[model samples]
Target: MLTHTKFDSEAIANHITNWLHDYATNAKVKGFVVGISGGIDSALTSTLCARTGLPTLCLEMPIHQADSHVSRAKEHVKNLQARFSNVSSEEVDLTSTFAHFKEQVPQAGTQHLTDLTLANTRSRLRMVTLYYFAGIHNALVAGTGNKVEDFGVGFYTKYGDGGVDVSPIADLTKTEVRILARHLNVPDSILVAKPTDGLFGDDRSDEDQIGATYEELEWAMQQNDSGKVAADFTGREKEVFEIYKRLNTINQHKMQPIPVCKIPLNLT
Candidate 1:
């Protein structure tokens, strides 16, 4: 078992909250906008935004969202609303919009829309909704991705979940986010819930899609980044490390800024 570097969750939470407040103030934005997806990351992000006393709009843009996940999201919003007057929530169901898009496409049959494309579409739709709200309210869209997903494997959609003005937990690993969530007194339902993007429509977990557990992925990422795999790594551990490295390489573009062509001028 790999050991994580320990830190105080309360202190980290305070640091994040203060950073958000200062960022919003400096940017001259009114408040923050976050898409609530009934996942731990979103819950923690929204909680941190609420702690800043900013007008945090937690939008639940569910496009054929699962009943259980929707319930979890609403419960999270209700708890936030009760605790902080600045926090508010609204559910904008996008099933019809998605269905219409799928319907109108000539070559895009319902079956032809691959799971990957559909999932990316759902994420981009939510991003559009978040920005729509942000533009109207002069707010920045807060991202809910953590280190493992955001940087390690790049398990998010570019210009979709990746489209955000601020990323609060990008430096923290998935495990660290869970610890911070507990410190913030997040609801037990959310804390104990299985991690998912809620994009597939069918109930599939992050582990199922990623082919490795968060702990395994985190350990592998650390090993890969350090250029030293543990000698004690067994058969399963070795396999996971291979997967981790391959994913990191394949998704490197998502972790980097858009490439630009620089023009060299002979001024001399």
Candidate 2:
């Protein structure tokens, strides 16, 4: 496991709250839209939005999501509602949406596309739902991506979960997020639950896909600026490094803003 500098949860929370308030005010965003996956990251993000005193909407877009997942998501929102104002929760079933898309696309020769396609569909559908509500409520979509997920492994779908008006925890590493979550008094079940995108089977997990635990991934990331150093990685560490590299390169587009062309003045 990799060691990281300890973070002050109170200070981090204060910073996050201040930034969220400023983002909402300056962007003229009336409220915040967050996708709650019943995962720690989303739970923390939703909680932070609530703490900001913004009208926060936690949308549970369950496309083949287990009943347990939905229950946990609702429970997290319930806890948040008791602590903040205008914490509304709702569910959108995207099972049909995914089924339709799957039928339309011809199956590739590999099972790879099956997972990738379904996961992408789920992410895009969730984004569409969030934006649809955002438009109606004049709110900005708050992203749940943490630094470890976004920077270390690029573990997000382009134009899907990757798109967001503001990212509150974009800089916090996964370990740091856990630390802050504990400080924020997030439920232990969520804090301890294995992280997963809930795009696959019930037993699916992020660490399983990445091949390395979040601790090792963070260590590898810190050791190499290019996220390529894995000499000390072991067990799942090596696999995590490989997965991280693949994702970073594959999702490079998500990391960049729209490009602008420069033109020279014509001489007459």
**Which model scores highest in lDDT?**
1
The CA-based lDDT of model 2 is what?
A: 0.83
Report the C-alpha lDDT of model 2 over 1-268, residue by residue, as the tens digit. Answer: 5454666789889999889988899998887999999888999898888888879999989888876677778888888888776789878888988889888888767899777777787899889999999999999999999997887678888889988888999998888889888888787778888888887747578877777777877876776675446565666666667666676677666777777876766832
Worst 10 residues of 1 by lDDT: 105-114
Report per-prediction Cα RMSD to one decimal: 2.3, 2.8
Report the backbone clash tally of model 2. Answer: 0
TM-score of every model versus the real structure:
0.94, 0.89
Q: What local lDDT score does residue 90 receive in model 1, on the 0 to 100 scale? A: 75
User: Can you write out model 1's per-residue Cα lDDT over 146-258, one digit (the tens) per residue?
Assistant: 99999999999999999999999999988898989988988889999889989888668999988898888999988887786645476998889888888899999999989
Candidate 2: how large is its RMSD?
A: 2.8
The segments of candidate 2 whose C-alpha lies over 4 angstroms from its true place after superposition are: 1-6, 226-243, 258-268
